[model samples]
Target: MSDPTVGQLADVVERTGRLIAGITPEQWSDPTPCSEWDVRALVAHVVGGNALFAAALSGQTVTPGDYADSADRLLAAFRAPGALEKVVTVPFGEVPAPIALHLRLADLMVHGWDLAQATGQRADYPDDVVEQALAFSRSALPLVRKQDGPFAPSEPVDLDASALDRLAAFLGRKVG
Candidate 1:
């Protein structure tokens, strides 16, 4: 349970990057499951997020960049020895290393699913990763707490739904 976040984050980044890189020029303007954000915008956000997380881990700040560069920076930062356990400053506030990892992991996983669905690709992320992220989301989302916040209430889905679908539903996304 004490494993570093670098490996898992790398997995998410690779999966997400595969989808982002596959997008055709025309597909860039297409609508995503995120509704508000188009393909290019969504890609930008994910990449930008990687940059931010990288900077936070290093106790530094960064200007967001495109997909390739941001991912490069993120991986470089996370690969440093003791990077995951190092305390750093985040935009919202400073947090322990583990907490920061969880926050980014949740975003990356959900956005990975979003990118896959929008681009007509499968979003079967690693089972263990999905399970861990889903478990975190169940408690961390405002839906379960009945609080008003950015997250919408968890929507109903079939009991036999895939874990990805279930997790998306919990985040107010409907998967077909």
Candidate 2:
């Protein structure tokens, strides 16, 4: 399995956003695999996630205020037409580029499934990226819930299921 590039992630994000944007209003308000978040909230999470990562890639130290502002901006952008063109280049610092790319791919691939499941749409991510994500998620499980703050709860997820299922479960979502 090879790590995906930032370009690949951007492409995936665009496709995923388009898929989500096409959902009916009723579907947008429906429950998701995330349990706590509805479809709208799930979209919000994805938009907010993009903003947060954008800030990170742009070398902004993550703060609650930054997250709020960026998230608001991103939500508005998502509401507008042709707003998925934003690209964020991650700065891995001491880490290898492939590792960072793999992480971003995992993030996009998982969230794509989240949106798809919420809207009763079928989604199948690239198998190569999924495999990379599975390996990354499995290796990172010990630190998932233990990470600094603002962490999503994950209970030592296993990558025994399909890639999408494993990715969803790793991110505290149930497989539909």
Candidate 3:
């Protein structure tokens, strides 16, 4: 049986890849909700993350490539036999492969929103994917924040805010 999480990860990668492909030349320098990273840097980070996760799963070093290539490598690695059952050492710490996958999914979800907000594009992420990412973020971010990790403290959002907006706010991005 295939891991359902892998499919979710692929869906996110495809959506984020589309967002990256849609970036206009002028918008490359636009500031993202990530604060320090502009559109170009943010895209680079996501691509690098894909490569990193692929390498972790495959036990082989992978140079950061273009978004589509990196995403392809990531999906291929995760689909490999026993990939999800192995433990991997990511930058933060050693974690189960499934945890790593969820981490990547949540990161891509929020970063995709950041890219969309920065470029004035619509973040048309699937509702189920957004919900899964949101659930993961809610459970994991508290520990990350305690370590003074990349995310800022969670900001307030309206109760009726969209899931994407809520996810962004939970990851410390201000939602209007």
Candidate 4:
């Protein structure tokens, strides 16, 4: 499948970030379908994921801590006014632009649901973005299954009876 446009990915991240930022402190500490992670921790996780994705695009090897650090910096930047674009344009390589964009898009789309669950807010991401993210996850499902680490699941499964629900289920969240 073709990668989403950069504007689309940026919109996904921006819109979801706004939703997440609007959440209360209580929600930040609430549990997510990720099991071990709460909303705040999940935020950190997504930030780390972005950092790793950016680094990968830049042809650099990155550790989880690097992603966490990147995430921390991003959150701080977001808390400031008029910093969205700068924060989103974190340094990334150009060689594999499509993959990097997909990574960013999928991260925002899935985490948006996580944040919604924790905050008791209902959100719907763009259908095109959700569809692309689902396709991306499905493509990587097999490789993800071979790892001997803790993860919800990669194979597609039944879910909440909607596109968004299916997308969430594919990402290991039990949303109905």
Candidate 5:
């Protein structure tokens, strides 16, 4: 039986790829919500992250290629038999493969939003996918904040804000 998270990861990867492909030449230097990383840098970070996760899961060092290639490698690594059932040491620390999957999913989803926002595109990720990513972000936020990780402290959003908005805010991205 296939793990459902892998399917969700694939969907997020595909959506993120579309967002990357849509970036116009002029927008490559545009500032994203990530503060420090502009459009090009944000995409590079995501691609690098895919490579990192793929390497962790596959136990093989993998060089990151373009967004499509890196994303494909990540999906392949996760799809390997017993991959999700094994523990892996990602950059953050040793974690169950499933948690690592969620971490990557949430990262891609948020960065997809960032890319869309930077390029004036719509982030049309499915509601369920955003919700699942949001859930994972909520669970991981405390530890992330405590560790003084890359994410800033969670910003406040209205109670009725959209899940995407909430996710971005929770990840320390300002939501307008």
Candidate 6:
């Protein structure tokens, strides 16, 4: 357990889950900074992602939003005995399970920010998350080739922008 990815995984998912649990029915229709996805769709994305990664971490096939307690289930799945060390069958290919967990940390935090922006809520993710996500995204950028891929090249940001803002910019998000 030398890597910090395990704990950060729980923190990112739990924080996003708590925020999503608080979303009112009205806010579901609001548009988010993610551009294409509305609040409800964004939530679905988070839940789906949680399910996918959780299933992988637990060495099972889990349909998205299949459980009522998606976030808690996600946390529990990763926390399961030997879950972290299990080999995950990802769509890309087989790799160490921890890499999958590490990838989720960046995805969840970004989507959490998307949810917060959509619903006019504040997420206050720790600075470490920002640091981790930025590093991950930077390293991952070279892997993305398609213009319509999941992420876009880092947009230009002012020097004063916070790390999170820079992350959003770097990930091709239009920061306001």
Clashing pairs in 2: none
Candidate 5: tens digits of C-alpha lDDT, residues 128-174: 77888788777766775664567788889898988888888888888
- Per-residue alpha-carbon lDDT of candidate 3 for residues 29-82, written as tens digits (9 for 90 to 100): 999988789999999999999999999999889689899899999999999999
lDDT (Cα) of model 6:
0.74
For candidate 1, write residues 1-176 as lDDT tens digits: 33336788888878878888777778888898787899889888888788898888765678687887888788888787787678877654676777677767778778888888888877657877776777877755543344554566678888888877888887888866
Candidates' TM-scores? 0.86, 0.66, 0.94, 0.71, 0.95, 0.86
In TM-score terms, candidate 1 sits at 0.86
- Worst lDDT window (10 residues) for model 5? 140-149
lDDT of each: 0.76, 0.60, 0.87, 0.63, 0.87, 0.74
Question: In candidate 6, residue 31 scores what lDDT?
Answer: 92
What tens-digit string does per-residue lDDT give for candidate 2 at 133-166?
Answer: 8777777555544555333665355556776776
Residue-level error in angstroms, candidate 6, position 5: 2.9
Instruction: Flag regions of model 3 displaced more than 4 Å.
Output: 1-4
Considering only N, C-alpha and C atoms within 3 Å, which residue pairs clash in candidate 5? Answer: none
Best-to-worst TM-score order: 5, 3, 1, 6, 4, 2
- How many clashing pairs per prediction, in order? 0, 0, 0, 1, 0, 1
lDDT of 6 by residue, 26-90 (tens): 99899988878898888888788888777777756777853246676778887888876777875
- Model 1 error, position 25 (Å): 1.1
Q: Which stretches of candidate 2 lie over 4 Å from their true place?
A: 60-100, 147-161
Q: Where does model 6 exceed 4 Å of error?
A: 66-68
Model 4 lDDT per residue over 11-125, tens place: 6666776766777866777888778898889887776776665454443455455333654443433334433333233333232445546656776777787777778777678
